[model samples]
Target: MIDPLIVLLIGFSVIGLGILLVAHLFFMDTVQKTRRGMAACAALTLLLVGLQLQHLQHLSSGADLLNSGPYAFMLCAVPAAFYLFSRDVLLPDVPLRLRDLLHLAPVLAAAFLPPNWVAVMSFVVGAGYSVWLARLVYGMRRNVGRFRFEMFFFGLFALIAVGVLALVIALPWTGAPLFYRAYAAAIGVSVALVISVLLIYPQILTDIHEAARLAYANSTLKGVDVEGRLEALNSLMTRDKLYCNENLSLALLAEAMNLSAHQLSELINSRFGVSFPRYIRELRVAEAKAILSRDQRSSALSVGMMCGFGSQSAFYAAFREVTGESPAAFRKKQPTA
Candidate 1:
């Protein structure tokens, strides 16, 4: 009889995969390289889960060794797709070279390995990719504020990667079927976790990509009057209420400050220790707080709009992030005449 725990795990995996497919259809752009790379990662993970399910349930005869080649190939490809996605996000200016193809040489070697050794080879390659990801993440520590919420999701995946490595290391004792079930469960949970984060923070990847550009790329602010430009930016935002324009953007603000978008970005990063978006958000939220205190009867939505938030939801999210309370709650806490 099949183990009930394995059955439960497989069910969770299927639900997570379903959510991922739905998200890819509705949420993903399908054009950007980073999005496409993420889609490939999701598709490959779904395939691995399906294959593991088939093997565990005895859905096919001669499945174990015969299907090993394809499974190992997909296993190796997952990390490759992920690394490409990271590169596209973090270092987009760096052109892809022909030698990058060597990352998949393990798949060719997998065909030569004994069936029992295929899983080991795949895990070894995965460990290397995990280490590479760690290095990339470490290099971005200076921009942690930009990746604050996003880092939690990244750390979750990192922990899952570590768990998979540990599972592979203990394979001699736990055996193949158990390992397959555990791996499937982990992938499923990760897919669901990603979908949930995307639902809540729809702009998570864009924010991270922008942050990575600031972290990994060369400075674009050389020989510039950093102090003078920051003064101008502050005057535009605080004295002139430039942030009150709902259509304001990085390029537009940079133009007003007589700097390039990259220069303005670096200026904010180095001086204010925050991203441009967060800087604008803080200004808007601070204005909203003053408005709320002055007039307690105005609706939060109106206050949000007057302060330049695009919508009520955006205002609430930014306000909570900055102040750790809802607008109404904050207003009520204030001493009203």
Candidate 2:
């Protein structure tokens, strides 16, 4: 980076460290072992921040590998660690050896990267991890209701997907024009900030609505104790008031469930085929149907409104879309039981 950008990057790098730190203290609980990965990310971010700052100050690289060599290349761990963090937090059952190696893979790979290749590896690892997150989150969207942790983590992981995409999309095109690069970087940073706000914040944000979505949408548990786990999680959702919380999101949910957002996302996807949004929608729609089926008082209440749908139009749209039956028509055929 140049002068100002160096400062900006360093500053934001510090901010990223702060974010990782907070996540460490509170968010690393469920997947207790993820602290190592988180630590790796923090260390990388701090190092990158220093490097960026040094670059800004026009300092020449020293002979030490740590100063001029590829040691700085270890920064790839930030994204890689975050990606692995998702895995650890979401899947506590998986043994650490398998997961730990994957989490640490980037660190090991960076050892071979020459200073010139550092940027390439950074992009490769960071962008690859981002893609991994996208695959997991998008793949597991439909299973958001399967677990509180999964749903919550899926939500948070989505932000990482966007951020990683932003960086990948923006950096390659930096050759277009100075203004373009500036605009692209700004957008990427802004989106990252937004994602951090929505996904990685404190627990209060992961509220009742999210829990409800997770509860009813949960169908990933197949013929095992998984259902019991989900049900127990669902009960917690209700008691914890997760459903009503509009700000409730993945990191918060994972934290609440003592899991990482990534691990939660993987569990839902592996167990079910849908992404987080669809999973929660399934719960919402299911609840709407039950309410329509049994409650006479719900007759006047549009199917959409009876459940967790935000608006009558949204409810009707979703109901018809999912069931292939208009809300009014569906209600007409059902006997109030």
lDDT of 2: 0.50
Candidate that would win on TM-score: 1
Model 1 scores a TM of 0.79
Off by over 4 Å in 2: 27-41, 44-51, 54-67, 98-113, 145-196, 199-337
* Clash totals in order: 0, 31
Candidate 2, 149: how far from true, in Å?
17
Q: Give the range of the ten consecutive residues with the poorest summed lDDT in model 1.
A: 58-67
Could you tell me the C-alpha RMSD of candidate 1 in Å? 4.0
lDDT against the true structure, per candidate, is: 0.72, 0.50
Which lDDT tens digits does candidate 2 get at residues 1-337? 4535634654665566567557656754423344555555556545545444434334333223323443445455556655554554444334467645675665676677564354455556665665665455455444433345444554564554455445435544642233223322443364356445444322212322233334334444344455554665577555654533434455676677665564454455555554444444556677777676776565534555545455565566556656878667767888755
Error of 1 at 221 (Å): 1.4
TM-score versus the correct structure, for each prediction: 0.79, 0.44
